[model samples]
Target: METSKVIHAIYTDDDVLMAAVKKVKANKYHIGEIYTPFPVHGLDKAMGLAPTRLAITAFLYGCVGLIVATVMMNYIMIEDWPQDIGGKPSFSYIENMPAFVPIMFELTVFFSAHLMVITFYLRSRMWPFKDAENPDPRTTDDHFLMEIPVSGNEKELHDLLVETGAVEVNLVNNTH
Candidate 1:
């Protein structure tokens, strides 16, 4: 199996990392990955990443929750134990909807928040008990790491990275 080389460019400050990301994109070098201690503002834009679809999924999940809440409430209140309470008819789901509105809203928010998180974990391939994929440990603390594939152009990439104020640059064998 052939092994490819990747350059790990370490940056101390987020501002310098942002500049490096933009410069690398302008030079048409594809960035493999980046690790930061915290979320960097506009890093996705700098890397030209597409907007996430999490919001769409969250909306869909919320709809599902609403449906589930409606059906469950209908079954429990109207079909199973229909009664008149407080001079109001409980036999009809529509007439009793006001009481269920709070429940439906709560379920919607609950489902959206929880399912969105689960979807993110699944999409990111972040399984339970999985080992961390970060190359440098410092990236989880104070440093930021940008990984760029070395496609027979290590010298030029290294120079550009250094010029971009990379604190350390390393060429490491990466096997897929």
Candidate 2:
């Protein structure tokens, strides 16, 4: 089966591009993606993207890290080798928490970073050693791009894009 053709419009000014995106979204057209050299504030909302839950995922992962660290440290220091060092009580977790702090912090950071990366990769459909899908090469270098899949009628979409002050309008093809 053939994929739908993607029509892309490149804009130089981010403000005008954002306005155009808002108009497109208001008109109920499906936006394939938007690429900008730098992040345009509120662009996700303009694109009607659902709010991300990455922060929540990170928090849960961090909690897991804390639990693992606490359990491991308690088992090793308190249970396995119960030696009172530095005039501190080995049996009291509350008293020995200061010693466990560094490891706890390290584990928290490790889990949060790893989990966030994995979540991003899964959400973006990217995998290790997989090439990234780039729609336009120049978009990575100082270009603001908006891409939309073409429906049966393209004249209005083209006119709207042109009127919205697109510097260049072009079609991207998957077929080589």
- lDDT by residue (tens digit), candidate 1, 17-82: 999999999999999999999999999999999999889999999999999999999999999988
For model 1, which pairs clash?
none
lDDT, residue 78, candidate 2: 88
- Please report, in order, the local distance difference test score of every candidate based on alpha carbons: 0.95, 0.86
Candidate with maximal TM-score? 1
Backbone clashes in candidate 1 total: 0
lDDT of 2: 0.86
Please give, for residues 70-126, the per-residue lDDT of candidate 2 as tens digits: 999989888888886877769867779987899999999999899889989899889
Question: Clashes in model 2: which pairs?
Answer: none
The alpha-carbon deviation from the true structure for residue 45 of candidate 2, after best TM-score superposition, in angstroms, is: 0.5
Minimum summed lDDT over a 10-residue window in model 1 is located at: 83-92
